[model samples]
Target: MIKILIVDDDIGICKILQDFFEFKGYETCIASKGKEALDLAKKEKPHLVFLDIGLPDISGMEVLREIKKSDPTVKVIMITAYDEEERIKEAEKNGASDYVVKPFSLEYLNEITLRKVYKQLFEDLRTEHQELTNTYGQIVFTLARTLEEKDPYTKGHSERVSQYSLDIANELGLSENEKTIVSHAALLHNIGNMSLDDDILNKKHEFTNEEKEVVKKHCIVGYEILQILDNFQEHALIIRHHHERIDGNGYPDNKKGEEIPFLSRILTIADAYDAMTSKRPYREKISSPIEAVNELIKNKGIQFEPELVNAFINVLAKKQIIIKENIQ
Candidate 1:
């Protein structure tokens, strides 16, 4: 289990954060003063720390400095008020991983904490192993499952996408290495959604233009998270462009047609098919498999590559044990 240290003079805030983190399966320790926090930092050796900018006994900045000097490996996140921009900057200079402002949402805190912790963990694993292994794949799937837990509508979504993507890869006679890339990319493509706020993710109404733009950042964020790993660079790039369209209209970079990576195009079709057939918060009803296939057919050559769409439909037919006779 992950261990966390919460240092704040505010008893209520400490209690609240302690309860929340504990409930989320993290072992937590709370300190009401800067000195106590430092002591805990030495004794507990926590994986992460949430240190407030203000403490009763000593300056939170001093405590931060002390913690970094004593154990530079521990990740510290400064907890600050909205106006302490300079202090936040200084804390960053002093080796704080990140900072969260006061009046923060628990959901947002959880998201950032998980991102940082996992990022650090992945980096550590990379240094030790120096190559991809079953452990790495399990960690990737764990991230996917963690996102699904936050949004019930997406339960099993990544697994289905992986299966579909693999099917498409095989249908197209991709090399074994290419199939492995497709599988890993499919599993982790939506891992960026973990960074999105729960409000936007669970909203029952269609997103506004601004909200859509915010959501699109997930692709870039996903890429950043995975690109740090040594051999996962291709998977990271594939995840980043999975949202791109065959036309020149896709987001982030808007690479068009053959400019977009071919594997990303395969993932695009698989992701879209599963999303269409699954229930979503904004959609009133789910699209039947046939309806979803027809939608893919309709969008082919525009949103998706025409040949990949046809191949995906065939993959679906084999699984559903039916022909595509109804899917013009």
Candidate 2:
């Protein structure tokens, strides 16, 4: 049977909701105070909680926090009077699953309850999806680390790129989701290098035109490999375009300007900065940090998005986030 907890200080309101939910085939519990609500939540462990924002013993927000802390998966639907937008927001941030203002119609409450019940019914599938996502992320990380182990010169390059990309993304005020895409794409940017010959990756001398052509194929190779995983389809596209130049002079497809993915633009600058500062098979010596920054400025609009270069410089100057030497 489905269990629902209704927490309200008003005895009349609690009785009304209890009768309504119980009539709808739910086993209902009620609490008229914050402490009582928390204790009931711990003991009953209901699948759903309709929590009020105001309680006599402690604030409803505190009770919501305690309930969530104990069981994050519990669906907490907050109850609030009108003109409590701030409190509603607080409840949401504290992990309330939904909110219903006072004096709501029974029909509306039923709709909300039905939605919650549906979620509860499919909760196992959601858990499995989350597990798969986590497992996939671990696999990507292991692949990146293995790629690095293949070439000592580029060791730790992906980590530095990911860090730099995150700093730049934060500076640009990108959304959390965008930052996540940038982070993962940067970490596995060179995953295609895993397919390259060891001599190509580790050569101490400059590559011939033919060798350079072969070397650049890692971008496409990485994209193909990453895209094979469902979780990495979008990220694979970013990785593929990371090597493309802003002027459309880059490899494979030669996509240029705004044609490149936005996060890819951010990843490009980070990748270049790290590559310059790091020792590469083609470079005689690692460029100094100052030199790398200058290169980014010089190549702006040619190799990277001009705005991203400016923001990246600002991130470096303002945040004091250091890029360790020999990253790329």
Candidate 3:
């Protein structure tokens, strides 16, 4: 479970925040003094801290500096009554993750907390890449789960897409190495969504053209983030082109036809099928598996490669994963 440290001199504010966060399923520790806050931070090693600028003992700014110096990974959100620009700058300089003034809304605070926590978790995952081996799939699944936790609408989306992609790879008789690459790439296809704002991600209304452009940037972002890993260079390139169309009408780049990577084509079919059938915030309801498959067939040779789409449909049929009556 995630732990939070609340450091404020106001007894009432501490009580309210502690109760609110605890109710939200976080383990919280409270401290009214800078010395106590530092001690708790050192002992508990909390993932997040809500600190007041006006501590009775040491300056909260000093505590922030001390905590960050000890462990730069610990996120600190500074709370202050004054909205002075100088103080805000200083807190940021000392590694504060965010600043909240008095009279802040708990809902807004929770939103900030969630964003910081997720951002930190992604960073940690990236660091863990260096230690990866045969356990790579487990680590990738953990990363996907963490991403889904942040966006409830896409829960199980990555895993399903990965499975679909693997099925296609197997149907095409891909080598074991190729299948591994396809599986990991599918699982991490949306890893870039981690950088998107919660508002844009969870918007219930249709996205504006600008929002669509912003959303399209995820492909590049995911590629850039994954390319740095030792053996993920190919995965990065495949992810970068997963949105490209067979006829040249897709994504960050407009690579057309056979120019698009083969694994990426497989991922495109799997991803589009899952998106069509999955519940989205803007959609009234999800399409049936048959409807999704028909859509894939309709778009084949245009949005997706014709042969891969046929192979994918056969894979679904053979696995009995779709409704029998729906297969035509």
Query: Who wins the lDDT comparison?
Result: 3
Which of the two, 1 or 3, has more TM-score?
A: 1
| Model 1 lDDT per residue over 1-328, tens place | 7799999999899999999999999999999999899889999999889999888789989998999899777788888887677877899899898888878999998887669867986787676675455467578679878888888888888888999999999998999999998998988999899889999999998999999999999999999888877677899999999989998799789999999999999999999988988888988546878888898889888999999998998888988834678766
Question: What's the ranking of the predictions by lDDT, best on top?
Answer: 3, 1, 2
**In model 1, which runs have C-alpha deviations exceeding 4 angstroms?**
1-140
Instruction: Give the Cα error of residue 89 in candidate 1, in Å.
Output: 54
Candidate 3: TM-score? 0.58
TM for every model, in the order presented, reads 0.59, 0.57, 0.58
Q: List the residue pairs that clash in candidate 2.
A: none
The clash numbers for all candidates, in the given order, read 0, 0, 0
Which runs in model 2 stand beyond 4 Å of their true positions? 1-137, 282-284, 319-328
**Cα lDDT of model 3 by residue, 224-274, tens digit:** 878766688888999999999998999889998989999999999999999
The positional error of residue 304 in candidate 3, measured at the CA in angstroms, is 0.7
How would you encode candidate 2's per-residue C-alpha lDDT over 1-328 as one tens digit per residue? Answer: 8799999999889999999989999999999999889899999999889888888889988998999899887888888887577777888799888888878898898986568756765885688787887787788789889989877788889999999999999998989988898998999998888887888888888888998899889889988877767778878999999889999999778999999999888988999888888887657546677678877878888988999998888887676544534223
